[model samples]
Target: MRITAAVLEQIDTQTVPHRITLEQIELDDPRDDEVLVRVISCGVCGTDRGCLHGVEPYPTPGVLGHEAAGVVEAVGRNVTRVHNGDRVMIGFPFCGRCYRCLRGEQRYCEKNRDLTFSGYRLDGSGGMRRRNGEELAGRFFQQSSWATHTVALEQQLARVPDSIELEMAGPYGCSISTGAGTVLNELRPEPGTSLAVFGAGNVGLAAVMAARLTSVEHIIVIDKVPERLALARELGATHTFHASSDTVEEIKELTRHRLDYAIEATNGANLVADAVAALGMRGTCAVVGGSSPSAKVTLKHADLLGHGKRLIGVMGGGGQTPAFLESLMALQGQGRFPLEKLVRFYDFADVNRAIDDSDAGITIKPILRMPA
Candidate 1:
């Protein structure tokens, strides 16, 4: 089958428009622990932008996308949890043998990282390729969801309720998961805690909303974007600080000189310092953004010496797969959380345009709709 796709040919390069031609490709029956999906909507995540624009490193001419949701077209023989026609979200498939997978942290899957980051198969075979039958270096972060149809490992697929709109369910793959999981799984803010989120983008706003759901009394959102700040307030932020303003002072004034936990979702290293300074004793600051290869952040040893403040780096929000996503959907269903306002839809061919909108802060989350 030939499909329209956006292919990143190299680092610091743009995704070239190409028809991904496949030979010997099969929608073959799922293996004992695999599933096939017809992807309907895939969100354009920051990582997807990075890969297309070359911030993080992945193989060239690769299909790089992670946030995806679709309907199941087939199920493996051993699969019983879900059947054909189920709605699902997919990520990279991880081998369950490693210590990370055993600990329920499948994001750090040992085998798939090489397969995922390298844009090749576990056996080093390229999944997407050129019309000449030469490999195009694909399999990014596992599902390579920038396509209309996808084959997902059962381990990485989440069965979402059919009542949910396909577009609304796509972002749970990365943006929403990163924010919600950072609070619920990593930081796990306690009742009456004070929380601050830097850079009120999709991830940061999600964190702010999650903080409101918790007993966290003070939710401070920091961002240079006025519209985003307004949206944050609408989503339950107790206070919003304009980054152009004296944000640190504003947070201090709102917090009575202390912050319990802070999540960093920006590229500015100084924002990290501000988050650290705003914390009280025994505070936790979770850094969830991916910086450039040369990007660095500094901390005062004295802050940790006696204050017992901890700064933690979280990858994929340190969450357990499927469970975190399911929990969020359930909350949304109960009307306790509404994440639909964050997304904007676009045609699949507008991949570059969507990235530009996300970069310009014109759109919070962009979902590219494939032709049905």
Candidate 2:
């Protein structure tokens, strides 16, 4: 079927910067294990910006969007989890045959790198083609959804309840889930525990909100933006600190020298060190932010071994998506997790503007409404 999509002709250069043009394109029919979704909305996440700024790799003349929610317009044979006309959110892609996937840790699938960033099927075939007969990299995250229609693996679809708005559910696939999952699934801070979140962007704020639902007594948020800090406090943070040299000191004072959990959800490597520094004895720090693949962090050996502190990495919330995403949706329905507060909507035509606003920190979570 012919569809409208935003295609990046090439990577961003110093002079010829990244650009996406709206064009009519052809999308192949769904394979036996795939579904065709009529994308209603999609969210622009930091990872998307990372690709746009050349910090990440994505083959160009391709569509880019993983956080998408839409109706199932068509389903290939052998698909049973969802049927046509069902509302669903597109989650991260994973090769089900991987050991990690078999163990229910889909996020850590061994082939995740190629499955997500290869811009084509694992078999080296792309689902989209330009009108001029050129193949377009369309399987980004197994659902290059920054277009009117997309083909996705059946396993990647998470059915959203009718009560939840599909427009607001896309981010749950990545950014929101990454932060909330890091707290709920990985950290699992006990009641009355003290927790500090390092960063106040969407993921950080989502962590703050998830932390509020926990027994964590003291929820402290640290960030450079005063406004984000203020918003964090509103969301559930008991204390907010300006990101500075005194951040660790202030958190120490608040936790009385016994911070139980710390989460690093920022792109900056320095904050990872800070989060590690703020942990109490045996405290664990969860890193769930997007950084360059080549980026490295140096930690003090004594701070880790001597104190029994753990520095762990979490990807896509570190668990299976069905239960986790459903739990979040249920929480949102009960008004316990008000993730909707962070969203701002833009017309699909304003895709670039939405990216610009997100880059400028003018928007927390930008959801682009695809033309209906």
Candidate 3:
């Protein structure tokens, strides 16, 4: 099928910048284990920007949009979970046969790196190509959904409840789930505990909202942007702080050096040390941010070992299941989650402008609405 897609012709950098442009591409038919979807909306995530700016790895001439929601147009012969005409959100892909996957930890699937960044399927086949017969990397997160249509594995989709607007559900596939899941599924903070979130971006604010649903008493948010900090307060943060030299000290003072939990979602601000430093004795810090492949963090040894503080890395919110995504959608329907507050819609043709706004902090979450 011929489809319109925003193709990343090459990586963008200061010396040699490139922009994603809409181009007509050929899409392959669904494979035996895949399903075809006509995407209605897709979220522009920081990870997508990371790839565009050369901070993350993605092959050139590729389509890139993982947080997608749409109706199933067709299904492969073996697909049984969903049928044509069903509304669904594309989730992170995982090889269901991996040991971690069998243990209900699909986020850590053995082939996660390949499934997410390799651009092609594990079998070396891509789902899209140029009009000139050139292959384009299209299997990003197993669903390169920047295009009007996409083919993804059967396991990478979750039904979107009828009560929820499909356009508002795409971010739940990645950023929203990553932040909320880290708290609801992984942290599960005890009653009356204090939690601090670093970086009040989409992910961190999502954490703030999720904490409100929990027994967490104090939710502290830190960010350089005053507007984001104010928005964090509106989203349920009990306290908000400007990112500065004394930010950790302020958290320590507020929590009396007994901060129960902390989450680092700075998207490569390298705030892991500060997040860890803000923790109290035996406190745990969840690092859920994306960074360049070569980016590394250095933490004080005693801050972790001596205080018994734990620094754990969470990928895509620990473990993603269809049920988890549905629960979030249900919450949104009940006005409890309020994901709409963080969203702004854009036309699919303004893909680059949407991305630019997100990069400029002018937009919290940009959902590109595809043409019907």
Candidate 4:
């Protein structure tokens, strides 16, 4: 079956529309441990924006999206985790046998960077591109979900509850997971802890929502956008500060001159300095934003030494866990997380526009739905 998809023929190039209908590219029917998914909903994430503008998988004519959710159309012989027809949200494929994966942190899988970005299949033949041999890189993050159908390792895809709408839950694959995992897995803030999160975009908001579930009493969010600041307050931030306003002093006053942990969601280098300065003793600041390669961030050494501040860089919210995803789904169901509200729907045809809107900060989360 041939399908239409958003194709980027070159890095740093605009998404090009394909008029020549291309048929589906098949894998050798999965590798005994693989499952095939008919992707119904895929989110245009920040990573896709970065990649589209030339970051990971530098070469172009690429299939960019990684946050995909769909039904399991088929599976290989050794695929015990899921059978055909099961709905799933694909995660980053982890080796499962690596030290990091053994520790239940698949996002940090020893080979995660290369595995997700290499633009080649483990065996070398990509399952994308035109049947005529144009060669589009598939299996990006092990699932080039920008297309209608995607092949995934059974290990990376998570089966979701039938009660939840798969389309609305797509952001959980990356954006939500990154935010929730940082607080739930890394910070684990105790009651009365003061935490400051810089940047109130999708990832920052996810952290805000997840932070509300924790005992952390004061959640302060900072962003340049006034609308995002207001949204953060609605999402669960105890205090909100506009980056355009008096930031550092306001944060100091909000924390009464001390802080517990600072989650840096902005790529700005100076905000890192501010987060470190706002911390009390034994503080941790986790950097979770996706910035361009040219972006450089610098922090002071004194801030680290004087207060025992720890800076940790996180990936995929410390790797998606069933428990975390389930909890996020449950929260969304309860109307607590309200992730759906963050999304603006776009027809599959406007994927390029949606990406543009996302970069322009016009849409919180742009979900591209296949034509009905």
What digit string (tens of lDDT, one per residue) describes model 3 on residues 41-151? Answer: 999999899888988889988999999999999999999999999999999999999999999999999999999999999999998999999999999999999989999
List candidate 3 stretches off by more than 4 Å: none
Clashing pairs in 3: none
Across residues 1-372, which tens digit of lDDT does each residue of candidate 1 receive?
A: 455566665555245442222222322345566676787889988877766556667766567778888899877788777778888887546777898889888767667558467776576755565666666655676677777766666777777765567667878878888888888888888888889998788888788767778998888888888898899999999888877547777777787777889899974334777788777777888988756656777788877777899998877766777777888877877777688878899988787788789878799989989879
Using Cα atoms with residue i matched to residue i, what is each candidate's TM-score against the true structure?
0.91, 0.98, 0.98, 0.92
The CA lDDT at 324 in model 2 is 85
Task: Please tell me which model should have the higher TM-score, number 1 or number 4.
Answer: 4
Candidate 4 lDDT, 1-372, residue by residue in tens: 455566666666356532212235433356677788887889988888777666544345567678888889888898888888888888777788889889887788898776688776667667666667677777688787777777788888777777679888678888888988898888889888888999888888999999998888899998888999999998888898877546778877777777888888873334666777677777888888776656666777777887678888888788455557767887788777788768898877778788779888999889989764
For model 2, residues 64-105, the per-residue Cα lDDT tens digits are 999999999999999999999999999999889988999999
Model 2: lDDT of residue 38: 94
TM-score, model 4 to reference = 0.92
Q: Give the TM-score of candidate 2.
A: 0.98
Candidates in descending lDDT order: 3, 2, 4, 1
The whole-model C-alpha lDDT of candidate 3 against the native structure comes to: 0.93
> In model 1, where do residues sit more than 4 Å from their true spots?
13-32, 76-80, 267-270
The parts of candidate 4 lying over 4 Å away from their true place are 13-28, 267-270
Off by over 4 Å in 2: none
